[model samples]
Structure formats: structure tokens, C-alpha cells
Target: MIVHDTPLNSYYASTSWIINITIRKDNWALTKTIQSLSFCTIPNDGFFEGIELIVTSSTTPSNGDKVVIHYYGRLAAKQGWRFDSTYDHKDQNGEPLPFEFVLGSGKVISGIESAVRSMKVGGIRRVVIPPSQGYQNTSQQPIPPNFFDRQRLFTTIFNPTRLANGEGSTLIFDIELVSLRRRRKL
Candidate 1:
């Protein structure tokens, strides 16, 4: 995404502003015009800092909204090795269950919360979370049911210190926002 301010001209009064944005992706280019400067809230690079985000949806969740998401998490240090996944979890009826959380509730890691903040229902995103925003402590939720994998995860995360300090691996999560519920007013 490239953004540049349009030169002041007779067509556009001084009171109003126009911003030209050019978005380019492999072999295709799109140009968008914003009539107001208020829309300039987007960062110059068109993305948030710290984590890489690939958005496949056009909608975003708001604060206090409840969200259901399915995720597959892997450690960057061990490429192709999955540390945890919602797909591996199932109920007694053999139905898959996604994780649920309210936005801004701090039920999940900061990276996940940040990533989910911009997602729409049925949208899938792949996020690369830095160690600082990843896991400072071991997470118990979304744990693998396999006994061997579970044991390995526990020992690796906890041994007098926390996981971030122990492994310090960058986390990559493929997340899908399954459902969303707006918060009700009191």
C-alpha cells in the first residue's frame, strides 16, 4: 500500500483533502481515493507494527464482542511442528469445538488478541507473533490431548522458568474467526 497526499487544487477546496492510495499485489494494482483526511488513520505502511497479518476478510470485530475462533499454532523454531491446535480437540460426540473469547478480555495471549481484533467472521488469518507478544507463561488451553505431545509441551514450557524465557520461539498461528456476537448494552 502506498499513500500520498494530493496537491491542493481548484477542484478540491482547502477545507477538504484527498488522499491517493495505491495497493499492489502480484500482477494487479488498485487505486483508492479517500475524500477526507480523517481516513488517514491507516499507518503509512498500511499495517500494524510488531506482527505480520494477512487479512482475508473485509470486516473487523469491536471491543467487548465475543468471538469463536479455530487455530493451529506452531513454533517458528520448529518449522512444520505443531505445538497446539483446536482441530485435535473434540467433544464426546466427536464434534470439533473452537475456542471462544471476548475481545479485550485478556483470556488469550496479546498477539492473538491483536490479530483477532481485525478479523471478520469466516475470515482466516496467519499471524507471526514475536516472542514478547507470544507466550510469557505456559498456556493450558488448546492443549493437545495426545499424552506424549502433552508431556513434551509441559516439560519444555515449565522447568523453574516460563516458556518465553525457556524456548523464546516465535509463534505462528493460523486463525479463523468462526462466529461473533455483539456485546449487549447494560
Candidate 2:
């Protein structure tokens, strides 16, 4: 665009200049989106694939309802342990127990509630819980030698299952939502 500031007079001189502008908002947004997605891709046969959701459920659970679940949790780090489980493994001496708790009741860890609330009956889901969500209170002093559960001895000798994770470690869980029911109102 050009503009003449001088009037149309023989004695008046007109000076016109050119100005160039570049608008890059769209390019900047696209670049940021691409950078973010780069961290979420999976390497499949030398090709990157987006994260996939596997769905196999019909009845979903909601907050304020009671839910029964079976879960197996393991630390994702190397030399990690199976910290918790409800799977019945005879050789492991584990008897699958149905864990029942009210949603949002705070009886269970934060991750469990978040996972359960999005789950359906008979559905299986794998979730990764960061340290912020589970066992954030690592500052609590370790249980004394006198304070121990019945299985502590067995775990000490044979397999260190149900291990206590270090503070800020990552935990991975395979949760199976068994059933859920609405709480009766008084």
C-alpha cells in the first residue's frame, strides 16, 4: 500500500515508501502443536503411530457409586516390583480378592478412583500414575521393625511382591472393573 502525503501541486514533492509485514500466528500454532504431538508418538516398525484407545466395555461407572475391581500394579522403572495385585496366582500364594470401595470416597488412591470412574463393567484398562497421585506422603516415617504385616516375612525371603515404591517413582496398573452399583439414598 502506498499513500501520498503531499498535495497535488507542481512545487510540492511526493515521497512514497513501501512497507512489508508478515503475520505468522497460524504457523506458530501449527509448529507448537506438532512439537507437542511428537512426544506422544509410538515407534512402530520404524513408523510413528498416534496413541490408540482400546475399548471393550458397555456399562460405565460414575462417582458416588460403589465399585468392585481387581487390579495389578507394578513399577515401571527397571528393577521394579509388583507392588500390588488382586490376581489369583497359586504359586505366588495370592488369592484374588474383589476390592470394593465407594467412588470418590478417598479410601483408595487417587489414581484408582480416576481409573474406575472411566471404566465399564468387565472392562480392563492400563493406567500410569505419577508420584503426585499415589503415595505422595512419603514423608511419613517408615514403619518400625515391630510394625509389619503377616506376609512381610514371606516377601522378605521369597519374592518381594507388594513392594513399597520409592518416592516420586512411576506406577503402572492393570485395572479390571468388575461391577458397580448406585448407593441407596436415605
Candidate 3:
């Protein structure tokens, strides 16, 4: 088989979509890979948040703490293209999916919860998640060398760009904790 890597940015730069996601922090074994990127250009203003998780920050979110977050994500590498916003999604009934959960509650994917637990409130980061902590055997990855079936990948609700099987896929997330308040121990 020929192993050829194509430039996804140059090819899938035209399509656009809006999406938002919430991620909770917890303990999880995440994978780091470069597969896709969210093309939702944040304003050039000072609001630009980098993809760096702060583990040493004080008062970090822990297990049993309810948290709120806002995020835009896509499959890692060439997998993340097109404008597929998860919030107030016009195509999906025009309502942004609300995300609030307790760390370590298994309410969200293990990869997401573990990633979120690594950040403090108001911190932004680009996290990469392995399939083990995510959908397990439920997700699919693109097949081989030329990884894009442009005609089908961008048009479907489930981006075809992110197709991982077997051991699972690694998901890339651009997450920011909007608010974090530990639930009162009553």
C-alpha cells in the first residue's frame, strides 16, 4: 500500500460551521496526536486562547465538582474541517448543546473529563484524547493514505474525517472552562 499524506488545510479550508462543546476534568489516559483542527477563527482581539492545559493552577476542578465550559472542537489532523458547531446548531435544531457535569462521574467521555480536570476555570487548551477514554469501539477512523472522501466526509452530520476503529480514535478538543464552582458538601 502507498503511504501518502495529503495537505488537509489546503483542501478543506472553504467549508465553515459553528460549534461549541463542554469538557470536564478527571483522571484519564489521553493520547497526543496531530490529526485535525477547529477552523473557527477566534477574533484577533486579545480573546485568543492557546491550547495549553494548566495542571498546577490552584483550586482546580476535582471529582464531584460541577463545572461549566464552552468549546469548539474537531477531529485531530485533517479530520477537523468544515463549520460544525455543537451549540445553537442551526442544522441540528438551532440549540447549542448544554454541557455541565461532575468530574469523574462518567457523565461525559473519559477523555474529556480527564482533559478538563487538568485545567482551571477560564483556562483554554487544545486537548487530544485517545479512543480508550472516548467512544471505545463506537467511533470510526478514515481509511488509509488519502484520508478524505470529500464528497461524503463534510456533508454528513458525523464528520467522516474522524474515522477510528480497533484500538479507538484520538479526538482533539479546543476547550475553555466558562465557570467552575465546586458543589457544596451537604
Candidate 4:
């Protein structure tokens, strides 16, 4: 399976204010539904992030092994709040961002690490990670200047799978598990 990595650019800075109004309106509608459903509260026991995902793959990942992941999900705000995408941006050298990560490693965020670990080859599960676990107090990639200071960031990882190496970080990929080859020789 070939995985294409894309840069997460700042969506907020690139778009005009007029376009944001429509997104904000849609976000408001979603927020209302979540509030009514009561699936809006933050999780206390598991990861503190407000996001969860169900991931499925064919091969399982071991510790210290670099597993490539390809995924696509959305970000939403917590209860009584909203996701201001205008301020949040993640891009590579000069491109819109796509999902890619090395499993079981700290290369990404804590929430992502936890969710990916709980997945198996061809398995899917929902992971809830609060803002604390998602991005916490970081002001780096994905999270823009004003958006980084906020309290939480939530995302749901859809059907995801492992990818091959040597792929550039600019391709939005739909990956499949080719195989899980061991690095050390027997």
C-alpha cells in the first residue's frame, strides 16, 4: 500500500471571511445536535481529548515499529464551544494537509498514539481524546496562532490502514495493508 503524506496548511488564513460564515453556521447546527444527544461531555477515565475514532487495518503494530497510517476525519468543538478552523492550519512546504502518521511513536500527538495502538489489522474502533490529549499546550503544526491557545481539539479517525515508505508528505492517500515485515533478521 502506498501512503501519500500531505502538508496541513492554515485553512483560516487562506480563506476569506465570507466563506467562514457558512462553515460556522454548519458547525453551529452540528453542535446543537451533539448537545441534545449528550455525547458532548468530556471523557474523564480514558484520554481527555474530545475526539474518538474507529480504525481498521489488516496488520497489528508492535512497539517501536513504524506503521504508516492513512486517514481522513473532521474536527469539531466541544460542548458549548466551536471549532474555529480559521485559526487552525497545518501545511507542509506549501500544500493542504492530509493524514499520515507513524504508529506507536511520539511523532504525532498523544490522542492519536492511543487510538492507533488500540487498532488491529482490518479492525475499527472509536477513540475519544480530550483537548489535553489532542494538542494540549502546543503552538506548532496544524494549530494556528490564535487557535492554538484554545482549550480543546477533537477529531475522528475513519477507516485507516498502514502505508509504504518513501512517499512524499503531500499526497492524500487511500491506503491498504500490504504486509508487516520485520526489521530485524532472524
Candidate 5:
């Protein structure tokens, strides 16, 4: 039984009609179930103009939380690359950043939220986001000017949650899940 239908639900329901899903894991965990239900099989060079995920998150995560995860493979066709350099703010003498931001409020890039919404509390997965879903035509720190045009940024955020306020950096996240609450229906 499907518990809650978040953005992922709508996305999969629409995309599934055009793709085939193959479940590789038989485990009956909630994460596995959701992934099995939403998994889509497309050729590596398929005409996917937007973001795609290997697995989708079952729990709804809020801002000001963090999640831990392991590294996985990543690739960007537009960039002609397969990986990005990892940086830990806290390791660089910068304070650990919070994962808090209003969903769909443009506080963070669309790619970050899209990736996070598809992740479970303890699940680790790789995400491929085109520049249009990411920084788009804008320039920011770490992301060089016009980088979006030359290449798409491929990041691996493990168990990503939201960040709290006063924390800088827009596109990337190193977070932990502190809580998951349903938003009241209007």
C-alpha cells in the first residue's frame, strides 16, 4: 500500500507510462518497495531531458536535518564527465552546515530538493541533474560562470536532509534527518 503521495508519486505516475521498471532487490523494506514501484528502465542514452534517480525516498524529510550515506557512481552526459570533487565544509575549518530550507521556495536549487525528496532517511543513491534543473543560467561560488552551459554538475549526496538558516552554500548538501512531519492540508 502506498503511504503518502508526494512529488515523487506524481512524477513516477506520469513517467511510468513511457518507461519500464525492473526491480533488482527482492527485499520487502519500505525503501525497496517504493524503489521497486517507481523504478524505470531506460537506455543509458535514452531521451531523458531532466533528472533521474536510482531510488526514491519513502519518508518525508523537513529542513534543519542531516543524513549519512555512502558514495555511488554518478555521470553527466552533457558534461562528458562522471564525477565531481568532494568537499567537506567542516573538514575545511568551516562549521558544519545545517540542511534547512523551504521546499520549492527557491532557497536551494531545484536539483538539490529533487534529489533529497527522492531519498529515504538512511538510503544512499546517486543523482544526475541537468543544468536546467540545477543552477541553470546563473553563476555561483564553486560553480564557475557558464559552467552550467559547458557541463552539468554531478553530485552524490548521501542520506541528504535539509539545512538550517544562516548556513551558506546553495547547490550541495551534507545533511542529517532530524525529523519528518506531514504538512497539513490546506
Candidate 6:
């Protein structure tokens, strides 16, 4: 029997991982032990409490820097409930144009600002944000193109604060930090 212990640093933790196991005829005795060990379990409701962040790539950008990103937003409670996207804005070459904003700026939502602040250029992250860090009021940007879709979103799950029932709304964002540049000093 052999045990391979891999020490993972904070940097390595941001990336994905894959575990593979190989067994020979002689290892059949250990197969029962391995099979007994549970590998992964996904929840039926697909709801994870609080913020969940998965980093697909990693890079570091400083505050006050101008950064560009591509993102898709959805309602966390509803599967396939994509509310808004930047994909509509594309260049003449047919490439999706990224949204640009300064880090730490109030232009975007608090959740987005918080997520992008820790990201590096070319880093992609999926973040689930609770109402506390999400939209407390109507945001002018990223509205759905279809009137009915927009109405459904705003009426149902967009702004928790605006809802009379006081139910909370959680949002999920898949964000990719495309590039960043240092803030120019005067």
C-alpha cells in the first residue's frame, strides 16, 4: 500500500483538480474499500447557502486598475434562468465585447466588484452571491432585451428590496477577467 500526499498551496487551490485511480488484479482486495468511499454528491435542489466561488483560472489585479470582463448572470434558485449577458455587444469581427470598469468602482454590483477584485487577468470565476451583496435596488445596466423577460425578472427575482414579501434573491455570475491595466497617475 502506498499513500501519495500532495501539498496544495493557496495558489494551487484556485485551479481545478482531477483524481484518477488504477487497479490491477492483485488490488482487487482493496477495491471494496475504495468503492465504499464516497467521491461526490450533488444536492437535489441545487442550492448552496451563502457565497460559492469556483475559479477556473487565476491571475491578480490591483484595485483602481481598469479591467475588462465577460459575464453571464442568472437566478440561483431557478435552473437555466439566465437573466442578463454582455454577449449582445459584439465587435464587427463578431467577437463578444467585454464590459470594462475600474476595480473598486461603484459602477457594477457589490458582488461583482468583490469577485473581480481578487481575480487576475485571464482568470475565470463562477460566483454565487446572496442578496446582501447583490442588487438592493434596480440597476440600470444588463436588462433583458425582451420586455416580457425583463418584466418577469423584475417582478419575480431581480430586486429583493423592492419585493413586498421581503423574500431574498440570490444571483450566480460566471465571470471572466479578460484584461487589466494599471491606473494612470496624474
Off by over 4 Å in 1: 1-58, 139-151, 154-167
RMSD of each: 12.5, 22.9, 13.3, 16.5, 13.7, 13.4
The best candidate by TM-score is: 6
Candidate 1 residue lDDT tens string, 66-102: 8888887776555546877876677787666689888
* Per-residue lDDT of model 5, residues 109-149, tens digit only: 45555555545654443333333344433332223223442
Ranking by TM-score: 6, 1, 2, 3, 4, 5
Weakest lDDT window of 10 consecutive positions for candidate 4: 31-40
Q: Give the per-residue lDDT digits (tens) of candidate 2, residues 95-122.
A: 4456778887766766667666766686
Write down the lDDT of every candidate, Cα atoms only: 0.60, 0.47, 0.47, 0.33, 0.35, 0.57
Q: Estimate each model's TM-score.
A: 0.61, 0.52, 0.49, 0.37, 0.35, 0.61
**Residues 1-186, candidate 4, lDDT per residue (tens digit)?**
111121112222233112111112212522111111111122234423212122343556655655444343224322223333321345554332334345545656555555555445543232334334545334422332343433333221111121133211111111222223334545
Q: For candidate 6, lDDT tens digit of each residue in 50-151? A: 122223355667778988887877875556488776665567876666788887777676777777776666555556665566665666344666687677
Model 5, poorest ten-residue lDDT window? 154-163
lDDT of 1: 0.60
For candidate 2, the clash count comes to 0
**TM value for model 4:** 0.37
Residue 157 in candidate 5, Cα distance off native in Å: 20
Instruction: State in Å the error of residue 79, model 6.
Output: 2.7
